[model samples]
Target: MNLSIFFEPLPEALFGGDDNPKSVGGYIAPFLHSFPDWRSAEVVLIGLPEYRGTAGASEISFQGPNLIRKELYQLMKGTGPWLVMDLGNLLPGIHLEDTYLRLKEVVEMLVDEGKFPILLGGSHDLTYGQFLGYEHLNKTVSLAIVDSQLDMQENKDAAPDQSHLHRLLLHEPNYLFSFSQLGYQAYLTPTTTLAALEKLHFELFRIGQVRQQLKEMEPVIRQADLLSFDVSAIKHQDAPGQQHANPFGLTGEEACQICWYAGQSDQLSSFGLYGYRPEFDHRALTATTLATMVWYTIEGFYQRLRNLDFQSNNFLRFSVGFHDNPNKMIFYKNRQTDKWWMQVDDLSGQRPPMVVPCSYQDYLTAVDGEVPNRWILTQARI
Candidate 1:
C-alpha cells in the first residue's frame, strides 16, 4: 500500500502539504486536508487508469483521475468538513479480468467500513469490473447508469469494453435486481439496442422525459444500489472531454441534480464517474464540472443520511391503484396523492377506457383482484 512512489515526485499542489505521501503502485496518495482521522473518512476515491476499452478513450483517460482530482481540490477548497482520500490509479497493463478482481477487493473493504466508494474511471467499460465488486457480498444491488448510449452490447467475445452493460445484465443475474438507464436519447443509442431494452422491460428513460418530471424520476434514482455515471451523458458543451460527445444531452447542472438525488438515497452505496479526458478539455471545465458533480452527490448523500434518519419510516406511504377490467384495463395510482391516477392502456392495447381522476382507495380496489406489472402514477390530488 506504499503510495509514495507515485506522489513523491509530484509537486505540492498534488499533495496539499501532507506528511510524506502514501504510495501504491496503481493508486495515488490522498491530498490530505486539515483532517487527522481522514483514513476513517466516509468517502474513498479510487482511480482506474486502465483504458483498454473504447475506440480512443484509453490513452486520453490516463489523465482522467488526475484532472478531476485537481479540479475538485480547487473548487471545493473552502468547503469545510468532507472526508475523502485519493487512492490513485490502477496500474496499466494488468489483464482486464485481474483489474476487475482488484477493484472489487478495494470496494468491498470500503463498504464494509460504512464508507462510500467514489471511483473515477479510465473509460465507461470499467463499470463491469466496478459492478463485480458487490458479487462476494451477495447483496442484490440495483444499477443506475447515466450515459448517452446503451453500453449493453450483445457480444462479450472480447475484452471488457463500453458494451460492458450487456455482459453485466446477462451474466450477473442473482447479484443484480434492476438496472435504470438514464439520459438515453433515440439519436445516440442504436434503435436495435433500444428495442432489446424494451423487450427486457428494464427501466429506461430519455433525458427529456426526466427533465419534464423529476418528481416521478426520483423513485427510480433512489432504488439504485450503485450509480455509474458516464460523462458523455452530459451535453458536449458542458462535458466536452468525453470521447464521444452528444450534442444535446443533460446539462452539467441537470446531471448534478440527478446525482445529488441518487446520492441522497439510502440504497445507493457507491458511484463512479467515467469518460473524462483532460487533454481534450478546454480550460479544464470538464474536470471542474465532474468534481462539482461528485461534491454535490456526496453532499446530498450526507444531508439525506443525516436529515431523513434512514432508520425511521417517516417518508413511507402507500397510495391509490386502478383497474378498468379484470384482464384488460389497468390503472396506476399515485402513492403521493389521493386523487391522482395515470391511465394505462388495456393490456392488449385494443380497448379504450375513460381516463379520469379517482381516489387512491378506489383505484386500489379496482386492481385488488389482480396484479399489474407496468403502469404510470401521478401526484395529483383527486
Candidate 2:
C-alpha cells in the first residue's frame, strides 16, 4: 500500500537509551532509519497525532504518541518472537475528514494483511476512522467502546470527538452488526441517550456494573471485531492526561484487564487507545499507565487461541430444555479457557442458528427455565 508516504519516522531521541536486551524498545523494529518490514510483523503500532477533530486543534497533543512510546519502550518485553513494528507518527491530512481517510486506508491495508493494528491517538474521534476501515471487508462487524460517556451527542455540528459515535451508528451501508459500550458513568450519560441505545438492542455496562462484575465483560469484549478505548474512561487520578478527565471511571488496572480481554478475543482485529494529552500529564503517570495497558494487550495477543471447534473433545456440552417453548438451549464450555457459548435460533431465517459467546450466568439462567437477556437481545437483532 506504499504506507511510507503517509507516516513520519520516529525521532531517534525518543528511542530510549535503555541498553537492557529485555526491554521492549530493544525488541521492536522502529521506523527510525527506514520503514520496518511490516509484512513480517504480527502487530503493528501506528501513532496518530491528529487533534483537529477536537476543538481548538491543540498542537501540544501532537507530542502524545511519542510520550506513550517513551514509557512503552522502557518496559521489559513479554514472551518470545516479539514481531512488533512501530510505524512512527501518521501525518494529519489537510482536513479532519482527510485525516480520517488516511487512517482508514492504513487500517484497511494492515487488517487485510492479517496484522493487528494498535492506534495510539490524539483524540477519541479517530475511532470513526478506525470504524471506516471495515467498510470494504464484506462482512458485518461488532464494535465495543469503552468510555466515561456515550459519544453519541445529538448536536450534529459538534466537534467530531463528541459527535463521532453518531456518525458511526448512522453510517451508510449498515455493516455494523453489534455495538456495546462499557464503563459509562450514569451521571455523565443522559437518560435519552441510554433509551436510544436500548431501542437499538445494543448493550451497555455502567461503570459500577463493570467494576462489580469485571469478568462478565470478557464475553462482551470477545464478541467485538474492533475496540476503541477512550482514556476518559479511566479516573482522572489514574489518567490525568485526558482533556475531560472524570473523577469516577475505571481504574488503571481495570483498564489494562479490559485490554487483555480484548487482545485474547479471536474476533478482534484492530484496537485504538485514544484521548491522551501529554500537556496535561502528571509526571508521566498516565503515560506509564497507557503503556502498561498496551503491554498487557500484546501479552494477551500472544496467548490467543484459535477458533473453537464445537465437535472437539476440548469442549463440554450441556442442554437445557424449556417446558412451554418446546425448544432446547444448547451450551458449550471450553475446557481449556473456561469460556462459554450458547446456540440461538436466527429469528430472521436468513442464516443458520448462530452460536454466540455467553457467560456462566447466562447458562445458569437458562437452566432455571428462563431465557437469558443475551439470547433475547441476539434474537431481537435478528
Top of the candidates by TM-score? 2
lDDT scores of the candidates, listed in order: 0.65, 0.92
lDDT of 2 by residue, 1-382 (tens): 6999999998887773558889998888899878888999999999999888887775565888899999999999998577999999999999989999999999999999999999999789999999999999898999999999998887867888998998899999899999999999889889999999999999999999999999999999999999999999999999999887678999999999999998889889999999999888989999999999999888889988776888799899999999998778999999999999999897667889888899999999999989999999988886
Q: What is the lDDT of residue 331 in candidate 1?
A: 41
> What TM-score would you give candidate 2 relative to the actual structure?
0.97
TM-score of each: 0.75, 0.97
Residue ranges of candidate 2 with Cα displaced over 4 Å: none
Best-fitting candidate, measured by lDDT? 2
What stretches of model 1 exceed 4 Å from their correct place? 1-13, 18-39, 57-61, 77-80, 155-159, 306-382
Error of 1 at 369 (Å): 13
